[model samples]
Target: MKRSDGLKMKLVDTYTMERVVAGSASRYPKRIALRTYAEEGSELTYSELKRKSDAVSLYFLEQGFVKGDRIALIGESCPNWMLAYFGLTGIGLTAVPVLPEFSPKEILHILQDGGVKAVVVNARHVEKILPFIRKKPEFLIRLEDLFHIPMPISGELKDRNQFLNAPGRDITRRKVDAKARQLLSEHRPKEEDPASLIYTSGTTGMSKAVMLTHRNLVWNADISSDVYFKVKPGYKALSILPVSHVYEFTIGQVLALLCGCEIVYLGRPPAPSSLLPALKEVRPHIIMTVPLLIEKIYRSSVLPTLKANPKLQRYLRFGITRRFIFRIIGRKLIVTMGGRVRFFGIGGAPLDREVEAFLAEAKFPYALGYGLTETSPLISGGKPKNHTVGVIGKIVEHLEVRLEEKDPATGIGEIAVKGPSVMQGYWNNPALNEEAFTPDGFFKTGDLGFIDKKGRLAIKGRTKTMILGSGGENIYPELIEAVINNQDFVTESLVIPEGGALVALIKLDIEAFAEKMALSVNEAKSEAARYLNKLREEVNKELNVFSRLSKVHLQEDAFERTPTQKIKRFLYLRKKDESSDA
Candidate 1:
C-alpha cells in the first residue's frame, strides 16, 4: 500500500535496530542527537551516541550476554537509558522498559514475567527493586556509572612496549574496529525478533506485557515519519511523556532518531513551573503531549480569563471576531510554549472539545492522535493543518481499520485494526491473545466510534464505559462529563450509573470557588450543597435528556488515575456502586 504522499509502504523483512543506529550515525555523525534537561545536562552527537552504545554492547558481550537474553531498563528518561536500550537491542537482547512510576510490586512482576537477566537502573530506582536482588539476574548496573565511564580509545594498549610499537598501530586499530563491527553484525536481530516487552499502562485493567518485534516498531516509525510527522533532520522535539510508554518510545524517541531530530528530555515531570523554563530554553519545534496537560492549561489559563471577560466571551460566539481575538492571545500562548512549536501532538486520550475548538480558533498548531499500546501506539493522526476539531484524523498508511458490529442507526462500533505495527500478542498469555483478536486477525481496540462522512474518526466513548439509560438509550458518560467539567468551579468529573439513575461524581476546584465567592473554606463547605444543586442544574441544560445526571456528589479527593492521568474509571465505578448500596 502506498501512502497519500505516493510513498509505498514496504515492510523490511530483515531490518534490525543495529542497522538503525548505524545508519543514523553514518548519515548525521555531527548532528546533535539528544539533549537532557538535568542539572548537569548534556547533549550527544550521533557519533558520540553510537560510540557509547557500542561500548555498552561490548561490555555486555564481555559479560557473556548473548542473543535473546532479556534486560530490564528502569529509570526516568535520560541519555544513559537510551544508550542502554540501543546497546541491548543492537546485540539482539530483548529490552524490557519498566515504567519508573510503577510500584515496587509492579516492577517485580514485570521483571519476573520477563525473566530479566540483567537490569540497568537509575540510583533512585535501586531501592525499589532491592527485594528482587536476591533472586539474582546476572548484573545490576547503575545508569549514572555508565554515563561517567568513558569508552577505551585504543582497546586498552597493554604496556609501554605495545605503545612504542606504533608502526602497525593504525592497522591494528582498523582491525579492532572491523572486529567489533563484525561481532555486532553477527548478533543483529531479525525483524521478527522481539525487540521490546512493553507492559500496558492499564487504564482499563491489569497490565499485560505486550511483545513488539523489531518490525512492529521500525515499520510504525517509518510510516509515521512518512505520513503523520514529516519531521526533517535537525528538527527539535521536546519529549515530556514517559519513555516507557510505547507512544513516547516509538514516536518521541525512535521516530526522532529515524529523522535525525534532536530530542530534549525534560528531567523533571512537566508540571507547569518546571516545563515553562525548559520550553523557553529548548525552544522545541514539536511537542508530543497527552490531553490532560493541554486541557489543564486551557482550564486554568484560557478558560478562566475568557469567562471573566464578558466582551471577549461574547466575541467568541462569532467566528471572525473569535479568530481575531484569539490570534492575539494565541501569540502569547506560543511565546509561553517556547515560541517555536510548529506541531503540538496530543494523544493518550480524547481531547476535550472546548479546548480543541479554542486551539482551532486561535490557529494553534495542535494535532489530535488516536491509538493504543497494542498498535505500537499510533493508529491514526494528521498534521495540525489538517486537524478537525473532535476528529482523530484519517487512518494511517499500511493499516486497515474498521468499525465492527455497528449499530444500524448511529453507525457506531468497536474500532478494530490490522497492521504490521500490531503486537505479536500478549506475552505468555494465550487466553488474552485469543480474546484480543478477531478470528480473521484484527486486534479489537475496545473503543467505540464512527467514521464521519469525511472519513475522519470521532470517538463516542470507551465500550467499557458506556452506560445504558433507564429508557434503554446509550449514554456516553464522557460526553456528559465533558459538559460537567466545563462548568464553573469544577476541576474534573466522572458520571456513572447507579440504581438505574445517572450519578455524577465531581471534584470541585474548592480554592478557586471559595476565592470567587469571597468565602472562607468553612463557609464554602457550608454552602456547597446549594451551590452543587445549581451547578447540576446548569450542567443538565448542556446535556441530552438521556445523559442528564439524576444526582451530583462532591468527591472529597481527586479520583485515582493511571500514569497518563486518565481517571481509573473502574476504581470509581466500584466506589460508586458501594456508596449506592450504603
Candidate 2:
C-alpha cells in the first residue's frame, strides 16, 4: 500500500494529539462542537457545550473539589453529560463515567470502587439510588447542580424547577471552572496522570476499574484515526455507542470532539426504523457500531431478500445486481442509510460471517477492530479485504506487537503490545497488574492472534476463556459459535461448555424461518428448532473431539448484552453442568 495523493499524515506522538484537541477547542470554540438528541429531537450545539462545560468546571471549583478527585458522570447519553466530562478532565480531575443501564447495586459498587468524591448524575436516575443518597450527601450531587445557575428564581418556574430542587440550584456551591482553567494554565496534567477510571463491563467478574491517562486515550485515538480513517473537522458522525465504554469514549466522544465532528447522539439505542429515519435526518458520514448490530442489520434486513432468490444473491456476490428486483433492494438500503455513510466501524464482538458477506455485497464500509480496556481498546483496526480476513488491522505506529511463542505453528499466539496507550495498570491492584504485563513492559492483551503474512492481526479468542480438554488441548468457544451462527436458521449462538462437553445456546430467527416453511409462528418454531438441531449436528461433526457439543439449547430470547453489545458470558458460566472434569 502506497500513498496516492499529497494527503499523507505523519504519525503524530501522543503529546501532539492532546495539544491538538485542546487547541482545536480554542480555535473552533463556536463550531457545532457536539449535538445531543433529546426529547422530540431537541439538540444542543458547540457554543452551548462550551458554556455549560465552563460553568460546570467553575461549579466544581466552587464546591471545593480538588484535583485528581474522581467525579462520576452517571447517566444515559446527553449534552450535559459530555459537558461534565470535559469540565472534570479539562481541569486535571479524573472522570468516572458510568452507564445509566447499570443496576443500582452495580452503580454503587463502581462509584465506591473508584472512590468517587463528586457525582454529577442524571436526575431521572437519582431515585434509583435515592435511599443511599443521605449516607453520602456530601458526594451525591445531581447534574443540574454542577453548572453555575442563577439564584433559585423564587417565583413560578416550571421548566427550571428541576434545577432548583434537591441537590440542585446551589448558586453559591462554588464557581470553579474559571479557577480550574487558571490552575490548568499553571499546572497542567502530564500525559501519564490518571485522567479517567473506566470500569470494564464485568461480564466475567467484578468490573475492574481500568485507569487510563490522557496519553493513553489521545494516543490510541490518533492511531485509530490514522489507520482506520483520518477524521477531519466537521466530519458528520453518528454516536449510538455508549460513552461509558472505552471504544465509544475514545472513538465516539473524544475522537469525534478532537476531529470537530458534530455527533448526532441518538438518545436511545437505534432501532431500524428510528435509525433509518435519523440517518436521513442527520445525514451522517461516519457511524461507530458493534459487530452484533451490523450483523443483525445484514441478517434481518439484507440477507433474507437475497436468500429468497439464489440468482439475486449470486448477482450480489459480484457487487452488481442483475435484476431490477435486486437493484431495488440494494437501493432501498442505501437510500434508507442516507446514501452517505462512508465508514461504518464495527467492534466490541465478532461478526457473523454471513452478515459480513451481505454487508460486503451491499458495499458497506464495515471495518472491524480488536483490543481490550488495557490498550485503550484499540490494538488494530482498518478496512476489510480478503488478505485481512478477520484480521483487526495493521499495528498502529509506535505500537510494538509480537507473538509470545515464535516457532512452527499456525502463526497465532498471545498478542503483547508495548506502547504509551497501554494502561498504567489496574488501579490499586499491583498483583493483577504484575501478571497483566510482560517482563519487558509489553502489556498482555489476553487475545490470541496471529500476524498474517500481510501483517494484519487475526484474533483467535481470549486466553482465559479458551476451553481446556482432558488431553490438555485448547478449544475456542468463539470458533464453535462461528460455525453455529453461520447456519441459516440461527440468529445468534454462544458455545457454553456443559458437563465436559460443549453446548451451543442458540437464538433463532423464528419469523423468517416460519415464513420460509410456510407455516404459522407456533408451528414454525418447532420446525425451525428441528432443522436447527440438524444444522448444529452437521457443524459439530466437523469440530475436534474435545470441542464437540453434547447438546444444543434453542433459546427464544436474545443473550443479555453489555452496553457495547457483547454477550454477558459470566451469566452463562453457572448454567454449565457442574459434573464436568477439571
Candidate 3:
C-alpha cells in the first residue's frame, strides 16, 4: 500500500488475490480448470492447479534454484503458461516469458540477453532455441518440464525426447547463477521489487527489456479484471491466445489466478477447425481475441449469409422473430466460448468500424479496449458508444491520463499516463528509459487519442505513425482509414501519405461489390476497377477537409503484419517502389 513518491496506489492485496484462486480445487474440485486443444479431452481443475503449483515450488527447492533466478518461460499461450508464472511468483521467483514466434536468432537474443538460468517452455517451442544451446550451455534448462508441478515420473519425455536425442552440444555445463533464485527463496519479492523483464518486439528498435515490478503486474491484473471483466468467483476463461503477448499473458494467466477463474488452456492453435469444437465443449464465459479473428467471421461467415440473400439481411435487421433467432445464434456462440461469454473483449489493434457496427446491431456485447504493452497493456475499454459510436471507454480509475504536446484544432496528441501499473523502467538501458518518462514522471504511451466533452476517449492513431504534411499539420493515417472502413463494402483500408499528399490503400469486399453490379464472384473481382472508381467517389464525398484521401490505391494482397497482426506500415513507408500514383 506504500509508494516511493508518496502517491497513493490502488494495490491488489496479494493475500486476497491468491486466497480463492489457489483454493479453487477445494471449492470447485470437480469443475474443469483447463482442456487441451484436442476435442473432448483431458481436463484439469482448481485443486489440480494448486497441487501442481506446490510440486513446482518443491521442484525448485530440489534443484537448489532460488527465488529471483530468471526462468525463461518459452511458449505462446496455454495452461502451463499460467502455472509457470504463478508458481514462480507464489514461491518468490521471477518469470521471463519468451515468445513462440521469435525466429531462431531472435530466440537466442532473448535467452542470451536475459541472462536466464533455467527454462520452462513448450516442447514445440524448444526447437526455436536449440541452436542457442551451444552458445549458452550454462544457462540452458528445458522449458517442457515446467508444465507439471512434480516431475512426470522421471526420465519423462512426452514431447521433449526429441531434444535429448538431437545431435547438439551438451547444454548442462557450468554452475547456474543462483543469486536471483536465492533472493526469491530468502525474501518474498515486495510490491516494488522487479518481478519480470519483457523484451519488446524489435519492430521499432532493438528489443528493450521492460522491468516490471511485482506490484506493476499485479496491479494491472487487479484493475483490468475489475473494470473490463468484473472477474469473480469461479469465473471461467478460454485461455488460447498467446500468453507471450501482454493482453493474453495477463488475462489468460494472471487475471484468472487473481479472480479464482478456471483457466482452460489448449496447448494448440485456435484456428476455426479446432476452436469451435472446444467452445462447444468448455462453454467458457470469457473469451479474448484481436480484431483479425472477429473480422474474419464477418468477412467469411456473416457476410456470406447476408450476401446470399439480401432479404435475409433486411429481415434479420427488422423482423422480431429473425432478431430472436439471431440472438439465439449469438447466445450459442457465447456459450461455446465457455457458457458465460458475457464479455467478448477485442484489443491489441483497432476494431474495424463495419465489423463493430454489425456486432452492435446484432446486440452482441463485443466490447473494445485500447492500450500497448508499456502500460501493462490495459488502458481504456468498455461497451461501444451507442449514440456517438467508435469511442474507446473512459479511463480506468488509478491511472492519470492527459494529452501532451498537441494541435488544438484536431484535438489529438500522444497519450501520457502515470500509475502503479506503469513499468519500473527498461532493463539496463537508462538512456531509453529516461526518454520513456516525462520530466513530471508520466509514462509516454506513444498512442494518440482525444477525450469527448462527456469524457470517453477515442484512440485515433500512434504518434509515430502520424504523417508529416507539407506544412506543419500532423495527419493520422488510421483516422483516415477509420472513416473509410465505415463504408459497408470496404473490407480494410490503410492510409499512407505518398508524394506529400494522403493516399488510401484499400481492399474492398469483392463479392458485395459484384452483387451490387450484378456480376459473378469471379467477374466482380476481375472488374474491380469499375467498383474502385465508384467507391472512391463515395469515400471522397464522405471525408472531411484534413481527413480526405487525395487518391485511392487498391492493393491485391491484404497486408504485411507483425506477429500480433498489427500492420507493418514502416515497410510500405520505406519502400520507394510502391504505387505512389494511387
Candidate achieving the largest lDDT:
1
Query: How well is each residue in 479-565 modelled by candidate 3, as lDDT tens digits?
Result: 678777766677787787766777777887776777788999788777876666667678777765666677777676887766567
User: Which scores higher on TM-score, 2 or 3?
Assistant: 2
What order do candidates take by lDDT, descending? 1, 2, 3
For candidate 2, give the lDDT: 0.70
Off by over 4 Å in 2: 1-21, 38-51, 144-167, 170-184, 313-332, 384-387, 518-529, 541-546, 578-582
Q: Write the per-residue lDDT of candidate 1 for residues 178-261, one digit (tens) a residue.
A: 788778667778878989998876656678999998888887877777666568899999989878888888888887887899
> Which 10-residue window in model 1 sums to the lowest lDDT?
166-175
- Report the Cα RMSD per candidate: 6.6, 5.1, 5.7
- Please, what are the lDDT tens digits per residue for candidate 2 over residues 1-582? 213421223333333223534555665676776665544434545655655555555656666777788878777776656767776775578988887778888888877778877667766676555444445556555564353323232112233235336333542234445655685455445667777898778556557778998878876775566566766778788888777788887877776776778877877778876777688888787888888776776677666766777777676555444434544655666567787776777888776665665555445566887778888878887773332346677776768899886435566688899876888889889988999888999998777888887788888887767888768777899888888877787878788766577778888888877887899999987776678678877997878778888788778888888877777887777655343333
How many pairs of residues collide in each model? 0, 5, 21
Shift of residue 318 alpha carbon in model 1, Å: 2.0
Candidates 1 and 2: which is better by TM-score? 1
Show the colliding residue pairs in model 2. 57-177, 58-175, 58-176, 58-177, 62-174
TM-scores of the candidates are: 0.91, 0.87, 0.82
lDDT of 3: 0.67
Please give the distance, in angstroms, between residue 568's alpha carbon in candidate 2 and its true position after superposition: 1.8
